[model samples]
Target chain A: MFQPEAGKTHLLNRMSIKIITYLSQAPASTDEICHTLAVKFQLTSDAAFLRNIDNTLHHFDALGLIKKVK
Target chain B: MTDKKEHKQAQIEQQLALKASEDSLSKNKRRRLLKGAVALPVIMTLHSGAALARTSNMIGDAPAVDAQVDMEGRLLCAHPDPTQPQIAGGPYDLGMMPSGHYEKQIDGNGPISLDNQAINCRAGGGVVISGVAYTSIMSRSGFNIM
Candidate 1:
């Protein structure tokens, strides 16, 4: 994704695309996103799925794409 | 010599000078033509070289795989050879999957313009999906596996 502010373009994987698209519609908690992705990806395990989603969420937090809602 | 003879000699010299001048003009014209002939190819060579450079830099560090973009600046899937060009299509809905193509992970902080769709992917390679950061940079380049 291209960040005009940063003047940089980021290349994303499929999973990232899913998360961004999901977030674009509305904000959701980490667990909500993790659950949605788990179903879509047909993930069998919860630990790895949650970890990946959490990591991605944290990364996005750093990027400021989404924020933690109170 | 007689005045008449002198006059005749002068006329002859004048004719010779005129002929020399004509010859000189023709030589100059030919020299100009030669220079132009040589310069034309050199100029063409320079232009083609620059064109090559721009093409190579078009994608910056992004892989040369065929990809497309939608009207809304969303990165779609790969083009099927002759059917679609790498940068063809309209705005693709965010949630919907574009066309079918292998999912290639492009990682780079390089600038990607919506105009040329020039993407620079240089970083780690994997299927990892990181979080989204807010930026004016609207489009992300990728192909849908569907």
Candidate 2:
């Protein structure tokens, strides 16, 4: 009775891969991850933009992809 | 009799091998699904943001110090030193010392030492000269030095 959606595939870009990979390596506070992204990838000027990435992490967590240790 | 036994054993081995392969395949699929679930949206956002910022120079321009301050503030707030009392109306002067007499002796003796020249052999009695330096600094600032 359970059916997975057919022909649906999730794709991630390189930068996202990089960010997630970094996060997976260690449990970092959201701000720390955002700083790393900004410094390493030159992502955005607004520090508040980090909140968007935090939201993304929450999404990943909901999917059982990542977890918040702290 | 040997042939029949061998055939039965082979069938058993084949069944085990098939089950093992199926299990491994299912595990791989589950792992891939998990990875996709976690990685996909993050990647999408990064890609989209990059694409949008490609036309402008403002991408990832956040000041480094601001980031450092944010990180430091987060760490400080999470596990602050218990000994450091919280104070109001200014930066918590962690370096400030309380208004009291602290004694340091050049010689290892009680309150008094008899011979001044013997001070070399025995620890000398050097009182805190005075808290003049500290008092001046505290009085001038008008801040609690505790």
Candidate 3:
């Protein structure tokens, strides 16, 4: 969950849900999803931002929401 | 004496050149023989190693058990030996069970799939359907039973 430089709350949970929905259709790697999210939100695709997405992906993996495709 | 010395030197040079030519041919043959000697054992070793690995992974006289379902047709039985090398990286090795393996309670339905059979057993208790044992992760709600 990245805090946007504004008054709006960081919707990490909502993004997690969206990520789950995206993964439900097809298996995607962390990098693929991170790049897509970065493009969709117009966020800078830096290490920190990618790390946040990877964290969410890992959380979903732990919960069995998404599986890492070989 | 100078002429004789020069003739002797030329004769020596001719013999040296002839010996060099013969040695080149023999060197090529020796190199080929060495390559054959080294490559034969290396290839044989790799081939034998692969065959041995295959044989080691084989489950000799493994039980021929078939997948069975309960009378209600809502259960899946396990037949594969978990300890077998053949099944090490198989589907059951990981979470072969679907997410619905533990759904706690059936939601407003008369028709549920075979995968949701564990839902009837609630939490804290495991359900063994058709010889397949399913251990619940959550005591009330949630998933993964294999």
Task: Write model 3 residue lDDT over B125-146, tens digit each, in one string.
Answer: 3222223222321222223344
Give all TM-scores, in the order shown: 0.33, 0.27, 0.28
Q: Is candidate 1 or candidate 2 better by DockQ?
A: 2
Q: Return whichever of 1 and 3 wins on TM-score.
A: 1
- TM-score of model 1's chain A: 0.85
Q: Which candidate is the best by lDDT?
A: 1
- Report i-RMS for every model: 23.5, 13.8, 22.9
The pairs that clash in candidate 1 are A1-A10, A2-B137, A4-B137, B70-B90, B71-B90, B71-B91
- Residue-wise C-alpha lDDT for candidate 1, range B1-146, written one tens digit per residue: 99999999999999999999999999999999999976542100111111111110012122233334334443333223232122223111222122232233332865355323323211221111111210111243333444
Best by TM-score: 1
Model 2, residue B33: C-alpha shift (Å) = 38
User: Candidate 3 on A1-70: residue-level lDDT in tens?
Assistant: 2111121222345566556555545556566677777777788889998788877666555543445443
CA lDDT scores, all candidates in order: 0.45, 0.40, 0.43
Q: Tell me model 1's lDDT, rounded to 2 decimals.
A: 0.45
Question: Which candidate wins on DockQ?
Answer: 2
- Residue A49 of model 3 has an lDDT of 83
The segments of candidate 3 whose C-alpha lies over 4 angstroms from its true place after superposition are A1-12, B1-146
